[model samples]
Target: MTIRLRLAALCAAALVLTGCGAVITSPDQVTPEVYVEQPSVSPAAAKRFGDDKAEQAYQEVTKFALEQAFPEAFLDPAKKTYTAAELTAGVAPHLTPTAAQGWSSLVTLALAGDADAQDSLRILQFYNVDDPGSELPPDGDVLVRQQITDATVDVEEPSGDSPERLLVSFRHEAVLAYAEAGRPYELDVTKTMSYWLAPAGANAGSTWLIASYDGRMDVAVDS
Candidate 1:
C-alpha cells in the first residue's frame, strides 16, 4: 500500500484504539512526505514596502508573537481568539517578566509588520516549547540552528488566468539543548515546525501562522 494509505490506516487505527493499549508501527513503516511551496511576492509591493530583508524580519516577528501567545488548548471558545492573559499566566511563572514582555513586544511588532519584529520573534520561537527550562550555550540560545529542510510556494490563478492569490510554505528543523538552575540536569530535544503565509488586509503586507509542529524529547543528563 502507498505511504499515504498506510498513514491513513494508522490514524484510523489510533482513533479506534483510543482507549485501548498502545498502537504500534514498525520502523520500516512508510510515511509520506508533505511539501508546501512559497509564492512570490509582487515586485511592486516589495519595492514599495521594503526589500526581502524587511519582509523576512516581519514574518519572523509575527511567528514569534503567535507562538508565545497561542499555546496549546488556549483558544477562546466564543471568539476563537488566543488570549494574551492565558499566555502570560502560563509562561510568567517560568520566565522573567522582562522575557515575557519581550515576547509580547515581538508579537505586537509582527502584527504591525515592523522590520525589527522578526529578530525578536525569532528569539521567542526558539524557546517556547514543551520544555522551557533548558539552559543554552554561553550566548543563551536554546534552539538548534539548522537550514531549511523543505519549502514550496503555491500561486493560484484567478478565473481569467490572472495571478491574484499566493501561498508560501516554510519548513525547518533544529536541534536544541539547555539546562536549568536548581535542577542538576540538562535536556535535549529535536523539533520541526512549519508555517503558511498569505497576504493579509487589502495591502501588501502578509500574515502567517503555524500550520504544524512535531517535537520529541531526546535525552536528559546531569549538568
Candidate 2:
C-alpha cells in the first residue's frame, strides 16, 4: 500500500493488475494541499544528537526496529492488501499500541492512493480506490513504471512528544513514470520521509517501534 515507502524497501506488491478488464496507462494526477504538517522535531536534531552516544543509539535502534518489522511488514501481494491486525502483529512488538494501530491507517491511505506509504518492495504503483489526487483506469487495474534510487538515512534527536522518542529520516531520488492524455511522462523527484519511534518498554535497553511517519515528495506529477 505504501507505494512510496514500499518502493524504497523493494517490498510492495502493487505492480501490474489484471482481471478487472481495464488496462491502465496513466499515472494519477496529484493535487497539492497547502497545509501539510512538518515532521515534528522535539529538540532539533543537532541539539539532541550533541551527544554522540545518543545519536548512535538512535541509529542502532532504528536498524533494530526495521529488522524486526520489515521482514513481516513488506509481504503484501498484488491482489491482496494487508489488514490492520496483520500489520500490527508484524510490527507492534517493536512499537507502541497506538503506533501499532496507526500503522493500519498508513496502509489504508496507501490502499487509497496516498503517496505517503512506508518503504517496501516492488517498483510499480497504482492509485487507490479513492483519493482525489489519484486517477485510475476503469475496473481499477493498472501497471506502473517507477524507479527510486540513492536512498540515504539520517537519525535525528528524540521527538518532543515525550521523554522517549526518536526520529529517523530516509531520503531518495526517484524517476516516476506515468501517462497524461495517453502520453507518457516521467517525473524526477526527491522524496524525504521519516519515522518516529519510541522505546518498546520503559527501559533504555528496550527495543523500538515506529510511532508515526511523515513523508514528502518534492516533485509534481500533475495534469
Model 1 per-residue lDDT tens digits across residues 107-153: 55444554344323322232233334533345444333222233333
The number of the candidate with the highest TM-score is 2
Overall lDDT per candidate, in order of appearance: 0.33, 0.39
TM-score of each: 0.31, 0.38
Give one clash count per candidate, in the order shown. 11, 15
lDDT value, residue 45 of candidate 1: 40
lDDT of model 1, residue 119:
29
Per-residue accuracy of model 2 over 1-223 as CA lDDT, tens digit each: 1333323421233421100112122223232111121122334544644445344535543344323322322322222455545444534455456654444555555556556353321121122222323333333223222222222223444446444445565443343344445555444445554555554566534555555554544554433
Where model 2 places Cα greater than 4 Å from the true spot, the runs are 1-53, 57-78, 104-165, 173-190, 202-206, 217-223
Give the winner by lDDT: 2
